[model samples]
Structure formats: C-alpha cells, structure tokens
Target chain A: MKRVLAVTAFTFRELIRSRLLFVWLISVIVLCGLDFLLSILSFGSTLQIFMDLGLAGMEISGLLVLLLGLAVTYTTEMDQKAIFLHLAKPLTRGEYLLGRILGFFLVNCLVVLGMGLVIVGLVVFLGGGTVPVLFYECVVFILLEMFVLTTLGLTYQMIATSMVGVVLYTFFTVFLGQCIGEVQWLLNQQLSHWVKVLLRVVYYILPNLEAFNLKDRLYDPNLVLGWAQWQDILLYAFSYSFVVFLIGWINLEKREFR
Target chain B: MERTAVVTDSPCAIQIRGLSKTYKTGFWFTPKVTHALKTVQLDVYENQAFGLMGLNGAGKTTLIKLVLGLLRPTAGSVAVLGGNISQRGVRQRIGYLPELPYFSKQHTGRELLGYFGSLHGLAGSALQHRVDEILDLVRMRSAAGLKVSGYSKGMLQRIGIGQALIGKPRLLICDEPMSGLDPVGYKEMRDIFIDLKKAGTTLFLNTHILDEVERVCDRVGILHEGVLKEVVPISKILESSVPVDYWIDVDGAEAAKLSGMPFQETVRNNGGVQVSGLVLAETLALLTARKAQVKGVRPLSSQVEAYFLKAIGAQAHLNRPIGGRRP
Candidate 1:
C-alpha cells in the first residue's frame, strides 16, 4: 500500500507539473464567456440555464483534463519508456495501475471542482441566489463519472500500443457510453434478435453513463433523490470500475516492455 | 579484488537456466517468430561486476529485461538473489538502469529520487537523506533542483544512476550505464562502479564500453546472435595471448628508412605504422637499430575488445571503430 501511494504521489506530481491546470483555466474562461452569452440570449429561468451550463462546463473540463493527461502520460510512460523505471521498483503492476488511475482522477477532481467553484461564485455574487442542493449532487455525480472514466482510460493505456490508440479508444468509449439512454430506448423497440443481443451486450459492457447524467434531468418533475437510487448508482460505478481495473491489471501483467 | 578471488564460490545473485524468448509479431495466421534469446545458461555471483558484451542486436538487453521480469521468457526460470523476481522483496534488492533511462520530464532530480526512495520504503527524513546522498554521489547536488526536462543527456544519465543506487540495492543491473556522458562524467560513473564493487554490491553491466569493462568488470560474458558464447574472467583475458593491434609512431624524418622493413603485415600510414603486438618489439628494435627515432607505441584496442571479437568469430571487425557498437 505504501508503494502504491508512492507511485500515486509520483504520478500526481507529474501531472500537476505538466501544467494540466491550464486546461482548467481555459475552461473557466470559456465557461464564463458562454454563461454571459447564454444569459443575454435566454428567455426565462436564467438560474436554471446558468446551473445547467455550469454543470456541463465542469464535466467537459474534467474530461478535457483526463484526455490530455492520458495523452501526455502515455507519450512519456509507454512511448518513451518512462514506465520501465517505475516497474523496476518494488511495486506490482496492479498497484501501479491503481495509483495511476487515482492520480488522474485527482487531477480531474481539481478541474471539476475548480469549475464548480467558479459557477457557484457567479451564482451567489453576481446572480444573488443560493446554490441548489442538486448542484452539489451533480458535482458528485460528475466525480463518480470521472472515476469510472479514469479507470477505463488507464485500462486503454495498458491495452494500447500507441498514444493515439489510447486516446481514440477512450474518446469513442466516452461517446458510446453517453448514448446508453438511446441504446436502452432501442432495447424497448422491436428489433432483430441478433442486433438486440449485440446492443444488450454493449449496454452491459460499456459504462451506464446515462445514470450519472443528472445535469440533463435536474428540472425533471419526477426525479427522485432517495438513498436507494444513490446506493444503486454508487454500487454500479464502483462495480464497473472494479471490473475495468481488473482487465487493465491483467493486461499489464501480460505486457512485455520490449 | 579479494572478493573477486572467491567470486566463483559465492552464491549466485542471478541464476538462469534454459532461458529463451521468442517474440511473435505480424499477423496471427501468418506470424513471424523472432527468437530474441536462445536457450542459454549463465550465472552472476555476488560482489563482482559482470559485463555482458555484444553487438547491436545480440540479445543483451533481452537478457537483462528477462532477468528483471520485464519480459516473460518462453522457456526458462531466473532466480534473482535466490528468489523469484516476481516477489516484491526480491525486487527490493534489485536496481535496474535501462539504456538511456528516461523519467517524467515534470520531475526534478530530487523529487524523482525521493519518489523512488519512498517506493523502496524510505520515508520522511530517511528518504530525504538518501536522496541527498544519491545526488551527491552522482554529483548532481547543484542540479537536483532543476527539472529533468531542462537536464542534458549526461545529467539525465547521472540521475539515472543515482535513482538506481537510492535504495542501496543488493544487485545493481545497468544497461549501458556509461552512455551519454562526457569524459569527466564517464570517469565519475566508472569510479562509482569501482566504488560500488568495493562496497560488495553485485553489478551487472550490459555495456559496449570496452574500457569500462576492462577497468570495472571481474568477468566478461561475450554474447553474439542471441547466444552466450563465452564467459571468462578479465584477468584471464588480460593474461591470454590475444594479438592486439598496436600503432608505433616513428619519426616523419625517417621516411626513407621505412622502405624495406622486414616486418610481417605492417601498414605504414602518414606519421606511424600500425602493426600487431607480435611484431611490435622486433619492429621497434629494427627501427632503433636503423636510428629511425621511434617516438611512441600504443595498443589500438583493449584485450577485452580483441577477445570479444575472437569469441564472436568476427576478428575482421577489429578496425570497425571500437566500443563494440554505436550504442
């Protein structure tokens, strides 16, 4: 556990010093700019628009940092062989993968929370309103999503032979993961048995990101905030992440650094 | 030197039997199998520097990676420090410096060392002290605060060695440890190896630097074409009757006296004549007798270089710009 923490700290320091926060800064500027523009153009309930846009900005910024972090670290660790030194240490491959996932998730948290703070500041100081409880819940959901994506991204890093491949795999997974709602809708529709089976497989395989898409349904009349839903979401996120993490660990163990 | 006397009796730091690696590449149906390491056997005992010498594609790095558990061997077992390398405790006793070692450019030398030290279970003040000692040992104290992205290749190599020694490992395995160093850095690295040897640390150096092997290694293993050809002591190679080339600098004013010399297989260049070690003495004697004013004589290659070429059956590669291969 100590060795895993060591690798975690090292990876965190590496990403921090790589100027990843600059992406957050850029996101903040873009978020503020878009908020200002949308405020002028929208018709009713500017607070709803503001919170929704702010939540989206936070999620986008978190994802941007994750993708960029994956690319940069992949070039250094896999392509340039920086991983050789780390693997040569007294750490297992599983520990290394876990540490890397935690480090990437930490950076994503910072970016997401940084954007959240900016949105909250805009709402409280400029708009003269109290922050909504759903806003905090949205941030937590975003964090859970980040955690799942972090594990999947690092798993792709383990399975990929090139930095471009890692990025592309993670990017497409994120895209398809967001379409879980549509896939669920298609499952209800009349379809061929073979196509349904393939879609069902993909549904169970890819992360149910739509479950964490709370920002889009914040104003839903029938949305429930019960502990049971929270329990299910958290359990699903962790269980899915655990499965992905295991695949990554197995691939890393079989990998030969030739 | 005393430890080297009993090196054969010492327990093996790394023991390999029937170790082989065949990489399968290309498509699955039409796969191309390249045997990276043939079924070979060798042992590196404790408290001695063992140099593995080979040409460009001679499986030296493959062997080192296999021993470190970075590569899975197709057909063998490696016992490092009398334990399986897969165990964390076994890895704790080993340090590996790959050829042209790279680190995350975001880290400074100190932070990198501190991180590696902490991985070895050093913490707090102990980790700091070890990092300081390693920085000083590798002579990177002043540059410790500089980010590795701004470091030169030699400085990177120094930090590479520093990180390898941070844990004070029982077995230090380095692939081309002296690469990318200036004359002074090279000397410092070589002296560090010598010092480590004296301190009873087992050194496994995969190097092409013949001078480093001659001055540091107790025994040298010559590998060729994924095969371990020979493993002989440096002392024996030095004592062996391998004929090395020599260059004798004769006076340029005695150009006319060099005309019909009775030396066998001697090539006269502009300022000197290159000859084998066998004819060096007789050529010098005849030159002196003719009053040709012999200036100086120097061996063209080290004994290890000659022995390596002879073992690989490539003695004709003698004049191919030594140091085994260009990295």
Candidate 2:
C-alpha cells in the first residue's frame, strides 16, 4: 500500500514537472477564445451559446489532456525505460498501473475542474449572470466520461507498440464508443440476425461514452439528473474502468520490457 | 523488527538452472520464436563481482532480464538470495542498473532518488538523507538539483548507480555498467564497484568487454549463442591466459652459441634469437655462460588468447564483435 502511494505520488509529480498544466492553460485559452468567437458569430442568445460551448470546451479539454497525457507517459514509461525505476522496486505491477491511472485521472480532474472553474468564473463575473446548477452537473458527467477514457487510454498505451498506434486506437475507439447509440438505432431497425448479434456484442464490449456525455442534453426539458440516474451512471463508469484496468494489467503482466 | 535475511546461509547471490528465454516476435499469423537464451546454467556467488561476458546477441541481456524478473524464463528457474526474484522483500534488497539507464528527464537527480527511495519504504528525512548520501557517494551532490535531461551520460550513469545504492541492496545487478563511459568515468565506476565489493555487496555485471572483466571480476561466465560456455574464476583465467614461453634478444654470436640449447628456439629476425620454454633463471645462467648481452625479453600470451579464442570463437565467431550480432 505504501509502495502504491509512493508510485502514485511519483507519477503525479512527474506529470506536474512535465508541465501538463501549460497544455491545459493553452487548451483553456483556445476553448475560451472559440467560445467567445462562436457565441458572437451565432445568431442565438449570446449567453446560452457561450455557456453551451463552454461546457463542451470542458469535455474537449479533459479528453485532449487525457489523450496527450497517455502519449507522453507511454513514451516515458515504455520507450525511455522510466518504468524500470518503478518496477525495479518492491512494488507490484498492478499497483504501478493503478497509480498511473489515478495520477492521470487526477491531472484530468485538474484540467476538467480548472476549465470548469474558468467557465463558471467567466459566466458569473463577465456575463453578469449567476452560475447555473446544470453546469456543475455537466462537469460531473464530463469527469465520469474522463474516468472511463483514462483507463481505456492507458490500456491502449499498454497494448500499443507505437505512439501513433496508441493515439489512433484510442481515438477511433472513442469515436466508435460514442457511436454505440447509432448501432443501437440500427438494431431497432430491420437487420440480419448475424448483424444484430455482432452489433449487440460490440455494444456490450465497448463502453457507451455518450451515457456520461451530458453537454448535448443540458438544455433538454426531460433531462434526468436524479439519484437513480446518478447511481446507474456511476456504476457503469466504475465497471467499465475496472474492466479496462484489468485488461491493461493482464497485457502488462505478459509484456517483456526488452 | 527486521525481517529474517533469507541470504543468511546461501553462499550464492544468484542461482540459475537450465534457464532459457524465447521471444515471440513478428505477426500473429506467423509468429517467430527467437531463442535468446538456451538452457544455460550459471551462478553468482555472494560478495564477489561476477562478470557475464558475451557477444551482442549472446543472451547476456536476456539472462539479466530473467534474473531481474522483467521477463519470465521460457524454462528453468532463477533465484536471488535463496528466494524467487518476485518476492517483494527479496527485491527490496536487490538493486539494478540497466545498460541504457533512462530516467525521468523531468525529474532532478535528488527528486528521482527520493521517488525510488519512497518505493523502498523510505520517506521524509529518511528519504532525503539517503538521497543526499547517494548523491555524495556518486559525487553528484552539486548537480542534484539539475533535471536528469540536462545531465551528461556520465552524470546519468552516476545517478543510476546512486539509485541502485539507495536501498543499500545486498546484491547489485549491473548490465554493461562501464560501456560508453570515458576513461575517468570508467575508472571511477570500477573503483566504486571495488569499494562495493569490499563492503560485501554481491555484484552481477553483464558485459562484453573482456578487459574490464579481467580487471574487476572475481569470476567470469562466458555466454555465447544462448549457451554458457565457461564459468572460470578470475585467478584461473589469468593463470590459464598467462604466457608460458620466454623470448630473448641476444647478440648474433651469442644466439648462435645458444642455438643448441634445448630451451632455446632461436628467432632469426632483427638479429635476435627466440627462446621457448626456458625458465628465466636457467636462461640467465645459460646467457651468462655464453657471455651474451641480453637486449630484450618478451612474454607471449598465446595461452591467454588461446583460451579467449576458444570461448568466443567456439561458434567460429572470432571476427564477431562483443555481444554477438548487434549492430
């Protein structure tokens, strides 16, 4: 347990020293700039458009940071052999993997919550409006989405032999995960038995990222953010993350660091 | 209370039996299995520097990885300090410095040591004190604040040794520890290894440099083509490799006078005759009788080169560079 925390602390310090915050700051600036530009260009209510884009900006930044973080740490841990320092210790491989996931999630939190704070702060001071409760809800859902993506991204890093492969696999998986709803839609329509079974298998295999994606439905009148919905979403995220984490652990166990 | 030291009765730091490693590469449909290490047998005794000499593709690194628990052996077993290498307590007392020691470039030397120390269950003042001590021991105290990326190769190697020593390990495993080091750096590292040996730390060095092995190792195991050819004590290697014949340069009349002597095999080149298999005292006595002016005496190392040639050239690889087939 002590060794696990030590690895976690070291990983966190490593990400910080890598100056990941610089990337976050730049992302936040670009996101805010785009929000400001789009809110003005669109003919809709400026406040509504800005708030909507700001919420999206939060998710985009979190996902972006998670993707970039996985790439950087993968190079460090695998390509540059930084993992030798960790694995050479008395720590187990599982503990090392968990520590890395937690550390990456923590950084994602910082970016997500940092961008959240920026959006909320800007809405309150600049836009002369009170922060809506829905924004915080969106942030929570975005964090949930990030939590699942973090495990999946790290798992991809564990399985991929190259940086380009890791990024492409994770990105395409994310795209496919979000399109699981479309697959379900196709399933509802007329389809062959084999096609239906394949789609169902893929649906169950890949995570439904859109479940935690609340930005699009923030303005929906019937959007449910009740305790029952919260319980289901949290359970799904934890379950998906655990499975991905297990896959990553298994892959890592079989890996030979030559 | 301190845990029971498992190494109390065991005389060997590392013990391997029929160890083999085959790496599966290429595509999934047609997997290619490359035998990195054949069923090889070797041991590294405690409190001695054991050098594993091999050519590039001779399974040196593969064996080291198996011992380090970074790779599972395809066959056989490896035990460190009388226990499996996977045992956490056992690993805590084993320090490893790889051939290409790449660290977190973002971390300073002190920070990197502290992180490694924390994993060994050290923290607060204990971690800091140990990091500082290691820094001083590796003579990197002044540059402890510099990020690892800014460090020179020598400095990186010093910090690598420092991290390995942070745990005060009973066994130190180094892969090519002195490769790429400058003369001064190499000398310093060799001196450090000697000091560690004096302190009773068992050292396992994987290297292809025979000269370094001859100088520092107490025992050497020659690995070639995944096979352990020989594990000889350093003293025995020196004795086996030492020259057996003596050559002398004498005046022409003196050489002619010495030609009939049973111990003298005369060399006609440069107006000097060669003497083979003559004891130094007897040759001097014979020279004194003949009124010979001794110009020079050269000791031939055909015996030593003979041993080396057999060990490395067993696979008919006399021309291959050290470590076997690596580019």
Highest-TM-score candidate: 1
Q: B1-327, model 2: which lDDT tens digit per residue?
A: 111122324487899999999998889999999999999887788888888988789899889889988999999999899898878999999999988689878889998898889888898998898998898888999999999989999899898988898999999999999866888989889888888888889989998766677667787788888988888777676666332445566765555666666555445534454443336668768877878787777654244344555677653332222232111
lDDT of 1 by residue, A224-256 (tens): 689998999999999999999999999999999
Poorest lDDT segment (10 consecutive residues) of candidate 2 chain B: B318-327
Q: Give the per-residue lDDT of model 1 (tens digit) for B1-327.
A: 332663688899999999999999999789999998898799999998999999988999999999999999999889999999999999999988999999999999999999999989999998999999999999999999999999999999999999899899999999999889999999999899989999989999999888888889999899888999989899999889888877777777776777787763444544567667778899898888888877888877878888888899996776443333211
What lDDT tens digits, residue by residue, belong to model 2 across residues A1-258? Answer: 877777777777778778677888898999999998998899967777888999889888888877787788888888988787678788888888888888888888888898888877887889887766777888898898888988888888888998888888888888999998898899898989999999999999888987977888767777768899899999999989999999999998788788
- Candidate 1 CAPRI classification by DockQ: high
Stretches of model 1 off by over 4 angstroms after superposition: B1-3, B260-266, B288-291, B319-327
- Measured against the true two-chain complex, the DockQ scores of the candidates, in the order shown, are 0.89, 0.64
**What is the alpha-carbon lDDT for the whole of candidate 1?**
0.89
Candidate number of the best lDDT: 1
Instruction: Report how closely model 1 matches the true complex, as a DockQ value.
Output: 0.89
TM-scores for chain B, listed for all candidates:
0.93, 0.77
